[model samples]
Target: MINNTIVQELIHEIVKEEEGVPVVECLMEGSITDEEIAEKTHLKLNTVRKILYKLYDAGIASYKRSKDPETQWYTYTWKFESEKIEEIIKKRNQEIIENLREMLAFEENNMFFACKNGHYRYTFDEAAENNFRCPECQEELEYMDNSEIIQQLKRELSLYENNGSEIAFNFKSYS
Candidate 1:
C-alpha cells in the first residue's frame, strides 16, 4: 500500500507541506535517479532532490552514488525503503496512541479552566496561581467542561489501538 493515503500522509509529514506523493509514486517504480524522478513527476530537480534527502534522513529512502568514467561526475540512484514503511507507520502510530493516552489521563485527573475566547487553558493549580484570570486577555477564567475532549481522545485512542497492528503492505515494487 505504498500509494495509499496513510503512506502518503506519512511522507507528507516527513517532507512538510510540499507534495511528496507524486515523487513517492515515481520511486515505487524501482530504483531510479533523482533526475529521472524529477522528469517523471514534473517536479523541479532541486525539489525532488530535497524530498529525496529528507526521506533518506527519515530512513524511508536510500541512494547509491556512481561515478561516470567519462565525465567523472557522480550520479545518485535512489530507492524507496518499501519494507520499512510499514514498520515506520506502526511505530509512529504507537507513539501517537501513547501521547493520546497521556492526554486522556491528564484530562481525567484534573479540571481545566479557559478564557472566554478560548485562547488559553490551564489546570486547576495553574488557574488558581493566576487567580483565574487569562494572562493574555486579562479576562476571568471559567471552568471548562472537558468531557467532550476526553471522549474524543478515547475514541481516537480506540481507533488507533484497533488498527495499529493490521497495516497491510501492497507496495508495487521493492528495492
Candidate 2:
C-alpha cells in the first residue's frame, strides 16, 4: 500500500494545482467557520466564503451550522471526506491504465517502416498499401524494428501494475 505520506502529498498537490478555485487543505478536519478559515489561510472572510462555497458546490466538502447560545451567532466546523479522495485517485489511476494499454497495443501489434534517406517512419500497413515506398521521398521503405518500443512498453506496464496495486490498497486501508 502507498504510505499515508504519499497520499497526503498527492492531496496537497492536487488541491494546490486545481484550476479556478482554491482547494481547502483542511476539508477533513471538520466544519469550519468562514472566520476560522480566513484566520487559518490568511485570506479575507469574503474570500474564504467564496472558496468554501466553491468546494461545497464541487461536492468536495460539507458544512453544518452551530448556534452560539449566548450571542445567537452561527459557526461552522469542517472536515474532509476520505472517500472522495479515494474516488478521485481511483479515477486518475484508471485513466492512466487506459492510456498505457493503448500504448502497449500500438507497440506490440502495429508494424512500422522507415525511409532510408530521411529516416522518416510509417506504420507497416501504410508502407504496404503504398507499395513499400516512402510517400514523402518516393524511396523504398524498410521494416522498422519493434524491439525497443516493446521493451519500453513492458517496463511501463510493470510500473503501472505495481503502483496501481499500492495506491488501491492504500485507498482501501484509509477508507
TM-scores of the candidates in the order shown: 0.79, 0.66
Stretches off by above 4 angstroms in model 2 are 1-23, 44-59, 64-78, 116-120, 137-139, 171-175
- Kindly list the per-residue Cα lDDT of model 1 for residues 64-159, writing each as its tens digit: 999999999999999988878887888888999999999999999999999998789999999999999999998999999999999999999999
Q: In model 1, which residue pairs have backbone atoms overlapping below 3 Å?
A: 1-170
* Candidate 2 per-residue C-alpha lDDT over 32-74 given as tens digits, one digit per residue, 9 for 90 to 100: 6668766776777776666666556545567788899999988
Q: In candidate 1, how many Å is residue 31 off?
A: 1.3
CA RMSD (A), model 2: 4.8
